[model samples]
Target chain A: MTSSAQANVSSPVRAEKPQRKQMSDMTIRNLFIAPTLLLLIAMNVFPLFYSLYLSFTNYSAIARKAPVWVGIENYVNILTDPQMWQYFNTTGKYTLLTVSLQVVLGFALAMLVKEKFAGSGIVTTLILIPMMLSPVVVGLFWKYMYNPSWGYLNWLMGFTNPSVAPDWLASSWARKSVPGLALFAVVFVDVWMWTPFVMLLVLSGLKAIPDYLYEAAAIDRASSWFQFWRITVPQVAPLLMIAILFRTIEALKSFDLVMGMTGGGPGDQTEVIAVNLYRKAFLGQWQTGEASALAYIVLIIIIAISNLYVRYLNRLREG
Target chain B: MATIELRNIEKRFGETYAVKPFSLTIQHGEFVALLGPSGCGKTTTLRMISGLETVSGGTIHLDGANITWQKPGYRNMAFVFQFYALYPHISVRENIAFPLKAEGMAKSDVYKRVDEVVSILRIENLLNMRPGKLSGGDKQRVALARALVRKPAAFLMDEPLGALDAEYRESMRAEIKRLHLSTNATTVYVTHDQVEAMAMADRIVVMSAAEVQQVGTPADVYHAPANLFVARFIGSPGMNLLAGPRRGEKVELPGTGNIYTIPAPQREVLQAATPEGKNVIVGFRPEAAMLNEQGALTGEVYATDMLGAYKLLHVSFDSDTVVHIRCDRMVSHPIGARVRFDLDPQQVRFFDATTEKAIGPTQSAGTAPISVQAANAQEKAA
Candidate 1:
C-alpha cells in the first residue's frame, strides 16, 4: 500500500518529467534555429508574398498613385499579348535545347574524366573554371568570338569561303541565326563549366558500385554495352535525374547570359521571358504589377520542377 | 554437372603472385573448400576456376575441355560473391531471376525458377523488396538463390557467409550444406574459417602463401597435416610442436627434460635419420599431451575458460611451452596449481628441422581425448 502511494506520486512525475524535458529541448532548438528561419522568411518569403500581391494590383512606378486592385487584368493582358507568348515560346525552346545539349555533353565529359587518365585532374579543373567565372564575362567573351570580321569561329569557317562571311549580329538572318547561336554559345559554356559537377556526382555513384558487381557482370558474360545499359545506367539514373533537374531549373531561369550577350537584340527576336519581363518592368514606364505577376509565374514553374526533384530524391533515399 | 580440373594455375597481379602454380581436380557433385587465411590465394584460385581472373600460366579444364581462355559464362559456372553483390535497384525476385534472364530464359521459366528458389530460401515475403531493404542473412540467401537459379556446371562461392552474424552464419552454413546435398552441383567454396570448411566441404584444400599445403577431407587435414604450416594452421588451439634432440629411441625435449620414445615401427627411421642428440621438432595435439598421475612433465595452470561442452586450460611448464588442454566444463583448477601431464608417444608425429616436413612414422595420433583420427580414417576411406 505504501509502494502504491509512492507509485501514484511517481507516475504523474515520470509522465510530466519527459514532457518538461521535451519542452526544454524544443526551446533550446528554437532559440538557435528560429532567428535564422525568421530572417529567411523576412527576406525571401516576404518579397515573394509582396510580389504576388503587386501582381494582382496595377502598381505603377511613374504615376505615384496607390495601386488599384485589378485582379486578373495583368494576367489576361500578358496572356493576350503575342510578344509575351513569343517570349514564352523562345524561353521554352532555349531551356529545352540548352538543357538537353548540356546533359549529353556533360555526361560525355564526365565519362571521359571518370577514367584514370593522366592529366584528367588538370582537365577537370580547367573545365570547371568556366562555371566559376563571371557569366557577364562569358557573354562578353562570346560576343567578341562571334564578331564578323576576326572572330575565331568565323576565321576558322572562313577557310571554306574566300569572301562570303555572314555578319553574326546584323540582318534578319542574323536575328534568327544569332539567338540560336547565342543559345548554343550559352549551352556550350554551361556544358563546359557544369560537366564537372555531373562528372563528380556520377564518379561518386560509380565508386559506390563495388568492383565485384562488374566482376559478377563479367562472369555473367555480359557484353560491355550490356553492362553499361544494365549496370552503369541503372546505377547512375538517380544521380543523373538529380543533375538534369538542377540544370533544367538553372536553364529555365537563364537571365544573366542573355542580358550580357544580346540585350533582347534586333527587334526583340532573341528576347527570352526574363529579358521580356525586365523590359516590361524597368524599360517600359512603370508596369511593376505585370512584372511581379511574370516573376511569380517563373517562381511557380521553378517550384513545380523542384518539387518533382525532391520527390525523386526521396525515392532514391528509400531505395 | 561436370568435373573441374586446374592444372598448374598461376595468377599474378603485377609483381605480386596471388596464386602460384596451384593444381586441383574437383570431381562432379563434390563440394570442395579452398581454406586459408586472408590473402592466401584461396579466393584467387576460386576466381581463376570461375574465369573471373585470367590465369598468367597453366590451364583450366572443365569436363576434360581446356577452358582457361574461355569466358566465365561460356564455361557455364556461376559465382556468388562475398559481398553478395545483388543489384540494389532490383527486387529480390528480379535478383534471383537475373542469371536466368541473362541466358535469355523464357519469362514463364524465369518466374517458375524464381518462385521455386524464393520458397526454398523462404524469402517469399521479401521477393518484392530491394536488396537495400533486406537484412544481411536475407541478402546472402538471395545471392545464393541467384547463383543457384541457373544451375550452371559448377558453383564458385567466395566467403558467402562471411558477412552474416555468427548465429545467422551457422544457420546459413547448414542451409548451404543442405542445398549442396540436394543440388549435387560441383561446387568450390572459399573461406578462412576452418569450422565452416570442415562442416560444409567434402574435401578441403588447405593453402598458405599462394601455395596449397594439403588437400584432403577436414579430418585428414586436421589429423595428418602435411607440413609445419598446416599442422599449426588447421586446428583450433593448433598442434603442439617441441624442438629437441633425439638420442637412440628417445627424443629429448629441451628445458623440460621430457623424453619421448619412438615407437618400434618408426625406430629405424629415427635412428638412420636423426643423429644422436640432433635437434628435431616433435609434433603432437594438445589432447595427446594429457593430465595423468604417472606423467613426465609438470605444468602450472596459466588460464582457464569454460567453453560449454569443454573447458580450455592453458598450462605453462618449466620449459615455457604453454600447452592448451581441453577438459570437461565441470572440471575446475586453480590458476597457480601444478598439474601433471603425459605426452602419449603413440599419438605423436615428428618433423625435420630443415624442410619443416613430416618425416618420422605417424601412428594413431588420435586416441587422445579430443581425437579426430577416426573421422580422419573414415574420410580417407570415403
Candidate 2:
C-alpha cells in the first residue's frame, strides 16, 4: 500500500514537472532565492568590498578627482597618528564603561524580575521603554536634562545644595578638574538606554531554565547563595555573554547619542571612534580613504571579540 | 533514617485545593510509594514533604521535631526529579558531589562520597561526561546517585524513571528497589505506574482527586482495595466492574441477565453495608475469572489479546459493557462466539452503588476458600 502511494505521488509530480521542461530541484530553488541573494549582495557585500579597496587608496569626497591608490599609506597613517589613537582610546573607555555597566545592571534587573509576581510584567515592560525609544530622541532629551541651569537633574541636585551640581558638559581640561567626566556623562546616557536590551535577553535565558532544577537544588540542601552561583549563573552565562557581545559592538560604534548630546564637545572628550570617522569622512577634510581604513580596523576588532564569544557559547552548549 | 510525619497537610492554589488535608507517617528505612493518576496530589504531597511546596495548613515533623516552616535546604532531604534535573553544565562527578559540597563537606570527603555513589550506581565511566552526553537511563542513575551521595534523612523520588524506555524503566525499577534495600533510607516515592509501586514499595498509598483513597501494603491494597477508585486504579487492565441489582443472597447482572449467589460471608457484609432494593457493583480481577464448561455467566467474545503467557479475551455482554477474562494462551475463541465464565466466590468483591466503598467479605476471611464455599453452599440451599 505504501509503495503504491509513493508511486502515485511521484507519477503526478513527474508529469507536472516534465510538462514545463524539467528543472533540477537545486536550480528551481536557486531561481526562487536568487532575488534576495542579489539584494543582499548589493546592499551589504558590495559596500564591504568597495570599502576594502578604497582603504588602500587616497580618495577624498570633496576633491572631485579620480582616486589614486596609496598602497597601505592610509592604513599606515591612521595606525600611527596620535590624534586617531586618542579617539580610539576614548572609544575604548566608553565601550568598557557602558558595556560593563549595562551587563551588570541588566543581569541584576533580570534576577529581580525572574521569579514573577504581581505587576512584575508591567514593571519589566516599563523598564524596557527606554531601549525601544529612538536613540536620537533619548540623546536630545538627555541633553536638555543635563543643562546646568534649569534642568530637572540640576534642580533635583540643587535641593541638597546648588554648589554641588558640577557643570556636566564642562571639559575637564578647561575646568582644570577631573578628566573624562563629559565622556562619562555620555556613557551614562548610553547605559541607561541600552541596559534594558541586555535585561530582555538575560530574562529569556532565565525563563528557559526548568523550575525543577531549583527545587532539586533546594532539596539538596544548597543555600540560596550557593544555588545562585551553581545553578543560576552557569545556566545564564552563555546568554549573558551574548548580551555583553551585542552591547560591546554597539558601544564601540556609538555615534547618534554622542552627536545629539555633545557633538564631540567639551574639548573632544566625548568623541568616540565612529564620531571621529564621521568627522574625518564628512566634515572638513572628507578623507574617505582614511576613514574607511579606521572603520575596517574597528570591524576586525569587533569580529575577533564576537568570534571568541561564539566559541565560548559552543563550549557552553556542549557541556 | 528518620520518621517523616505529615499532620493534616494541605495545599491550596487560590481557592481550589491541590491536596486536601491528608496525613501519613513514614517510618525510618521504609519504602513508601504515593501512587495515583495525574492531578491526584501524590506529587504535591511529595513536594510538601520535601519543603519545596508550602502547606496551606498543618505541620510536618521530622523525627518528632516540627520543621513545618523550615527552609527546604534545612529540611535535610534529597529529591530526585522526574526529568533528572542534573546540572547540565557539570560532569556527573560534580553533579553527585554537589550536595556534599553544598553542606561544606571537605573536598576530600566529597570526592570519596561521590566515588562511592558512582560505584554503587555503576556509572564510573560516565563520571567525567556531562549530563548532555548521557542517555535517559544513565541520566536517571546520575540523578539517583546525586540524591544518595549525601546520606540525607530521607530520599524523595518523583517518578524518576518516568522518562525512560520500557526496558530501562523495568531495569531501573529493580535498581531502585535494590538501592533502597541496601541503603535502608526512608523513601517516599511517587509514581502513577502501579507495577512500579507494587514491585518496589513496602506500602502503597493510592490517591485520587487530591484525596487519599487507601494506604496499605502492596498485597493488602491489591487484594482488598478499600474503594472503587482504588479497585479501578491499582491493576493493569484494571478491575472489571459490573453494575447490577441485589435481592437478598443474589445479585442480578444487568448486562448478561445472570444472577450470582453472594457467598455467605460476603452476603453478611452486603446486608450490613446496603439496604434492600438497591444496586451493588461487582468487582473482580481478570485473573480471578475463568472459562468453564459449567460457568455461571455467559457473553459473546468481542476481542482477544495474545500476551505471550496468557490470552486476554474481551467478552461483550449487552451492547456496551465488556468484561475481560484471562485465559490460557492456547484457549482461542473466535469473535462472536458465546463463552461462559465463572468467578471464584472467594475472589469476588462487591461495592455499594452510591458510596462505591467495598461491601464484601474482608480480605482475611475471604482467603479461606474451602470453609467459605461450604458455608456459601449451605446459605444458598437455605
Q: Which parts of model 2 are misplaced by more than 4 Å?
A: A1-43, A159-164, A172-176, B255-257, B360-382
Give residue A192's lDDT in candidate 1 (0 to 100). Answer: 58
Q: Which candidate achieves the best TM-score against the true structure?
A: 2
Which stretches in model 1 have alpha-carbon errors above 4 Å? Answer: A1-46, A159-163, A166-189, B330-332, B344-346, B360-382
> Tens-digit lDDT track for model 2 on A1-319?
9999999999888887795555678888999999999999999999999999989999987888988999899889988989889998999999999999998899999999987799999999999999999989999999888876566777776533434555676644223566777888898899999999999999999999889888888877888899999998899998998898888888889999999999987878888899988998898979989989999998998899889888988988777
Scored against the true structure, residue A201 in model 2 reaches a CA lDDT of: 93
**Best candidate (score: DockQ):** 2
Q: Residue by residue across A1-319, what tens digits does model 1's lDDT show?
A: 9999999999899887886656677698888999999999999989888888999999987877998999989988888999888888878887787767766776777777778888988987787787788878887887777666676767776533424554554422322444455555555555655666666677667767778888888777677787788788788878887887887787777777778777867556568888888887898656999999888888788899889888987787677
lDDT (Cα, tens digit) per residue for candidate 2, span B257-358:
578778786677787777776899898899989899788888999999999999999988888789889999999899999998899876788888997878
- Give one digit per residue, the lDDT tens place, for model 1 in B88-191: 87888887887777778899999998898888878889989989988898899989888878777788999999988998999999998898888888999999
Clashes of 2: 0
Error of 1 at A15 (Å): 44
